[model samples]
Target: MAAVDQNSLRKLVEGQLLRLEGNAFQDCMDRLGLVLYPGDYQPVRAAGPKGDTKNDGYCPKARVFFAAHATRGETFAKTKGKIRGDLEGCLQEHRDVKVWRFLTNDTLPGEVDQFIDNTLRPLYPDVTIEVWGLKTLADEISKLKQGQVERIIDVITVDEPEFEVVVLNHMKTGRDLWPVLSNCLGWLPHEEPHDCTDDEQDLIDSAVQSFRDWSDISGDIEFSRFSVRDAQRSITAILEELAEKRLGLYAATTDDYPLTGGPSPFLGTVAIFRIVRVASE
Candidate 1:
């Protein structure tokens, strides 16, 4: 697939920020918080008769509080007053705050920046204050994962055409198969595994080092006469030999595997390999 145009995406996000205000702006920020912190961002819901908690969201892990003030043609003084009041209320209610982020829909005025730096910082000597205007919000949203960003904002992506297929019957072998598979097939490595256990991490590290060692000694395995049919025959032969020796690798050939509904147009005949992590079974 074609990579997302980050510059264009950021501009779109900034434009959205400029347009949205009040509850809509607050909701957008909440969605961004969810994407940014994943499970860590806790959004403060509606306030009762006692009035709002001032904090729109809080990330407990980072001890960061978010207060959104979206203006709808409000004056500089009015905007500043709202921000100052929210900060005071949030500080009072949430004493453990290390960073208080003030989120706004539009670019902050010079006087607003001065007020926060000179007036607010002196009042709250311990807590750090941050202002996230349209540009700042756009920059942050742009850096997030493509999938996460897609959930928050409208995105248009180019579709991938005719990709070489890798059908692993046993998918748990994970990306340890990438180096060898990438050499055999034309599959390019894309994503990395996240939150791996110690043992899994060790295996990944060892696999990487092994690939490096092999490359340094024998150099990269290149198939100058590489073709889809030739690759299929080679893989099938290898897997069948392993199976015969009871080395725990299995192979199956089928034309039923779905790529764009039924079998890939690129690889004519599909061969699926089941890789088992065992000497014999």
Candidate 2:
């Protein structure tokens, strides 16, 4: 990728992070928590009345809790309120909370940042309080593997538009594919944040390679040497990982079928994820 494209992609990813609100932003933080804390990170969903059990999530191993409050153009007062409420909830509701990290989209002013360190720290002397804004989230994402980053971002923009979607879509879809493929592959949920081991990474890499290989097969080649089942499994692995209900790949035109003597029989799988923006949420 060119520097310009890389810059564009970074901005695109960061923009998405900053713009996400409600459950979408909380979901993003859950994904990030899984990456940053691995097996220890547990995403807490909002209960009917309890409301996330006083925290959005936590890592038992580290005794650290996380709370997400993502809103665009939010005032410092609102942010501070959320921080105080969530922090108090976590501290009062949970035991042995060594750290309470508030995740938000808006950047905190220097004074607000200092206030957490100073005023908040004194009130909650037993637990450390920290806030993570867009930059902090982006920095954490930078440390992830390309596969992991693609999953979080849902798409990777680059020079080659087709390859950009093809590779990254598979990565993004891998999370979606987890449920369907888990039984067959004996794999963990890719969509959920978890500690990915080396063997798990290898499984993911192999699935990606298989999809690429299947996609690259020449139509003129003899079918006898290839295991159609094996190829199907690979393709299935990739497609299953994609956003199913919100996204679909349909033939744009039947006129392009090989029987029609069309120049390009394949519309290209790149079309499958053009709407990832909708699917990702």
lDDT of 2 at 113: 87
TM-score of each: 0.53, 0.53
True lDDT of residue 26, candidate 1: 81
- Local lDDT at 151 for model 2: 59
Query: For this target, which candidate reaches the highest lDDT against the unseen true structure?
Result: 1
Off by over 4 Å in 2: 1-9, 156-159, 162-281
**For model 2, how does the per-residue alpha-carbon lDDT over 13-80 read when each residue is reduced to its tens digit?**
46557557798888888888887888899999877977778888999999999988874677778767
* lDDT of predicted model 1: 0.60
Candidate 2 residue-pair clash tally: 3
What is the TM-score (0 to 1) of candidate 2? 0.53
Tens digits of per-residue lDDT for model 1, 116-165: 99999998889999999877888998798776665554333435444345
Candidate 2 residue pairs in clash (backbone atoms < 3 Å): 173-241, 177-240, 177-241
